[model samples]
Target: MKKRFVIWTAGIYILYVLVMGAYLFWWADFGVPEAYEGTGADPATFMTDRQLELSQDYSRYQSMLYFLGLPLEWIIYLGVLVFGVSRLFRDFGERVSRFTFINIPIYVLLLSTLTWVLTFPLDYARRTLSVNYGIGTQSFTGWMRDQLISFWIGTLIMAMLITVLYVLIRRFQKRWWLYAWMLMIPFMIFMMYIQPVVIDPLYNDFSRLSNPQLEEKILAMAEQADIPAERVYEVNMSEKTNAMNAYVNGIGSNLRIVLWDTTLNKLDESEVLFIMAHEIGHYVKNHLLWMLAGSIAVTFGGLYVGYRIFHVVINRWGNTWKVKGVTDVASLPALLLIFSLLSFIANPVELAVSRNAEKSADEYAIEMTQDREAAVGSFQQLTVTALSDVNPPALVKYLRYGHPTMMERITMLESYQQ
Candidate 1:
């Protein structure tokens, strides 16, 4: 069974590398599409040759890092199981606590701590690359602080989830995935509700729009979109990165507009309005609610598939891995490994859905604002500030990007006429 698992893992990793590497190195369609010729939507028209090279290099390295990182993560999970490390941690947790619930969190903490330590090099490499490309400005200490915060937050959430998941597994045995999916609905919504107000504030200071004139203009646009927002919030993003972004976050009363200070400083008033209008498009079109529903559906599918595979793998390798049963806390790595593979497989589909929604939002922004220049300029500014590859490889777009490529967005904006 272990040999088969290793062989399958090798096959999948090789296949992934072959496909992605071919697209990265051999594919060469990174230019403005023929349909958009003479439209002044070309990156060549706005960006210097050096800027274009930098963007492409940044994109390439970042994509490679991401590609390499996924399998490395999978290996880390598999290593713990294969080396008996998972069982050792479980036993230590048991020794530390008499209570099952206490032992579960303790085991999770140990596992997460180990995972964090193993992955820090990959994280550091990503940070170094980002900083070198001028996409990241946060100091190493600040970055480490953020990493620690993220680690704790993630570990806490995983502990809660694993605790509940195991309880469900013990109770239902065969149908735990279904109940877990059901529970995830409310849990997801609650997290979304608190994220903007509670969790987001941990990273940056969010305040009402500082520029009164800009705030008034944004507020008018919000009223036009029927967003029921009296104010726009701005975050101090300049301290961390050079990228620009704006979004609508939260659900119900918590819903609000958030503009990065980087965006406000980089783009002019018309461009800012166009960007905000794009966010409003999301709200008006119910994209968030639809995305939530789609995610729930996808989660249901992943969990069901994972449940099937989990039983098969555990039944085969339980004794070898020293796992007591399906419900054993030590089985966390096995469960995560299965889910990770499922997630990787499902990513392209999720990204495709997201790109469709982004395209819809772009159309809405153009139709609502009727400022093609602003719309086109906003995308151009984004490309320059974020070091975006205007036309990434088709496979990269399909697998990695959640929004339309910068060139695609520019073309769409340029084509839209009043």
Candidate 2:
């Protein structure tokens, strides 16, 4: 009986993947709407317009899937949960089925509501607490409005994606992960190229860098580093958030430097230069490509292990978080549970790699600029402006942080200076 049950489960899983893979491939190649091109405005204006278009497209696609997915998902989850439960407590099958079919929807709805409620306080803390600390500029009303907008927008989009994912998994079963990864590649590419162009501008206003001398200095630095200098662009970020930042993105003609207005306003020219130097270091080192390759490799490895363990657990106990195939609603909770646990275990390893990359960038900045004081000041200003915890616990740092803590960075800078 056990052997028969295992075979039945495996068969169902394989069929699920085959169906979902076909659907995902169709959707990836054809389902996406036309790309939006903004008017040839300044960099900031172009960015804002592009973001709005992407957000609208994303929202529309999401809404359609959200409403379509609910009932279908529930039915599959209930069917799988009942069948799996029956293997353990055969006599209690009827009772378990009755209880689960009724209780599962209620449980899920409550959980979703609770998550939204928890996010409210976290948002409040980010805004109100930052204001109290003199790091934020938005009024209470502005913050509240922003929070509400973000919440509703996030809820709608996530709800839709969850539905789509549930359906896909139900259709794909055990081999669903492979197809999902394949689908993710194009989605990730779209996000990388279009996201900064279309999505970011919705919340913030962008303007060109107004300082000629500073712009010239930045161009010089890029040229000195053997980075294409023409791609450098300044953005007015002060109209929305006060957080200071700089980043280097894209490659070849698409490559560009983005300096937020907050960084321009807060940091002196030298400090700004140092920050840009660090970002340029990332480009010079080809860190972005490395990160992407590393992430894909890790994900593939993790999924393989997870797939083996999932089948083993189900075989041993006849009760698994794994629901019917992939597209089923019940499968979502199981996948979420398993993925969350796996992600938690993998956090340290991921963070270690990220921290090393950051360290390398820091070293590169120092070497390129030969300006230790500028680096120290830039680090200090970043910590203060972002309101980052200066002394996070070691364990928390390992699990949660990508970059070394501010104190550690400053200490390193000091050591380099000596």
Candidate 3:
């Protein structure tokens, strides 16, 4: 029976991979637009001639393909969930109730696939669009090198973390979810600190902010906000891409504001100051801490609900999904399937919390800058540079987007200006 179950599971997994791989390739080729043509006059006026062209090209390309690519990706994810759960229950018997050696690769593959899919659009923007627009300095080879490095690094870290969690779950199978989450808090802190300081630097250069005047202005803003001023630093992001971004990252020793080199080059001194102030707002408000808390709360809640549902479903049709041990390799698909379903149900709660935080940040940015026009212009520039959808579908945005739409941001700024 075990051998037969293994054969069926292998077949299903192979089919799932083939179908999803084909969909990905198809979306990349046909779903996206090849170029962008918009009303912004004289690329030289707004950005470098090469940068302007590249921006337009990416915008066009993305707009063309987004709708098609997004839906297909979601469908593929659902398919994986369905087949994975089915196989898990069939292969592992009662021993699956314990966390075991079975299905480790399956979980890893599911995680890797999800990560790759979610980040692919961003990666493409950074590599292909940013380069074509003249904002990215990295070659295709360089981008590929970065991707490979990130993949290995991510795999190693996640493997260690998952292994530890799996072991803990085996020991405390009855209350594993709660204990795992307790472990996650420290893990998250470690990730935030090391991710930027160590992992990110592997892909891009990190250095002290070079411009003293600009640095002072940012420090002054941080002081005005009553936050630590010494944590601001610059990273050589322009070495890879022209997309401008700033964020506050880490806890304690890891805490700092990282500014992309491209952001400094593109925005004037005041614009840079305003952007830094906005990021400082996140720190002042303790947005990161609250966000982490919210995520943990939701994850634990979901796991609790999932644990009850899994037992109930198995009681009725335990033989159908083939779930044996909670720790078994076969059981992974069942766990993932349940988790995805729970996440889908909890989507609105997650979106509302994220949207609220983003809106708060936007308000903070405007208040700090007191220059509505600069804020508005910055919003527009960000939309254009990032090739972001100005007006995405409401349902799609609700399901996927963490930030408010471009138009929503502009509208908010316009009201503030009035």
Candidate 4:
């Protein structure tokens, strides 16, 4: 059974690699455009010839990292499962549980902690690359401090989740996944509600926008969107990154529109307003609610798939894998591995939904502001300053990208009548 399963997975993996390689070769732009042909004369004016060259170089470098780091992370996870590292961790946790009242918490903590340690090197490497490219400026000590905070916070959350998951598994048995799916809706909302106030400030300092003129303009835009404007935030991301960004996050009273100082410093007034309007569009259109609903639906479907696969795989090789049952802590890595593959295959569907949401926000921003030039110019700036891949490979776009390509966004804005 084990041998057959291994052979089957290897065959699927080889086929996957071949298909992706062909897609990259044929669809990934072999050469990027040297100059812009967007709205106003000389979008190239925003970037010097030297800057343009550097942007392409940076884009290629980062793309290479994505190609390398992404597959390697999954490979490492699969390796851990194949080598019984999860069984070893489960044994350690069971030993620890002898001293504690609950085995699930101990097991979850150990599992999360071990996986985190294993993954940290790659995480650190990616951050190092960002810093080397002049994108990130956080000191190693600061970075470590943030990582520690995040590690603990994430571990606590997962512990709670795993405890509940186990409870569901034991009580509902066959219907556990459905119950977990139902629970996810409110759980996700609660997490989003707390994130702005609790999680975000652990890393970056957040303050009210200091520029009163700019703040007033943003407030006005929020008012237009009918979102609350009293508490806009500016994260001190300038200390950590050069990338410009803004987002509307949180639920209900906790909701906030946060701007990175990088955006303030880099973009002009019109461009900033357009960006803010886009974020406001998300809030005004109730995109968070819609996305949450979509996620709940996907969660139900995915959980069902996981439940089915978990039983099938375990029944075939449970003895070989040293896993007793679905509820056993030792089975987590297998379950996770199944979900990982499911997510990879489901990437295109998820990305399509996200890209559509982004497009809706883009259109909303344009309609509200009626500034085609500013809308197009804002994205053009992102392509230059942020090294956003303007024309990624079709395969990369499907598998990796969450938002529309910068060129697609710029072209969309330029072609818009209203």
Could you estimate the TM-score for every candidate? 0.95, 0.65, 0.72, 0.89
For candidate 4, the 10 contiguous residues with the lowest summed lDDT are 36-45
lDDT computed for candidate 2: 0.59
lDDT of 3 by residue, 201-247 (tens): 78777778898777877888878887755856898877676578998
Decreasing TM-score order of the candidates: 1, 4, 3, 2
RMSD (Cα, Å) of model 4? 3.4
Measured by TM-score, how close is model 2 to the native structure? 0.65
Rank by lDDT, highest first.
1, 4, 3, 2
Q: What lDDT is reached at residue 324 by model 2?
A: 35
TM-score of 4: 0.89
lDDT of each: 0.89, 0.59, 0.64, 0.78
The prediction achieving the highest TM-score against the true structure is: 1
Residue range 89-200, candidate 4, lDDT tens digits: 7787777665323777777777777778877887887788788767788899989998999889988887788778878887887999999988998898888889999889
Error in Å for residue 362 of model 3: 2.3
Error of 4 at 198 (Å): 1.0
RMSD of each: 2.1, 17.3, 7.4, 3.4
- Once superposed on the true structure, which residue ranges of model 2 sit more than 4 Å away at CA? 1-114, 140-168, 226-231, 235-242, 251-254, 305-327, 386-389
- Between prediction 1 and prediction 3, the one with superior lDDT is 1
RMSD of 1: 2.1
Q: Indicate whether candidate 2 or candidate 3 has the larger lDDT.
A: 3
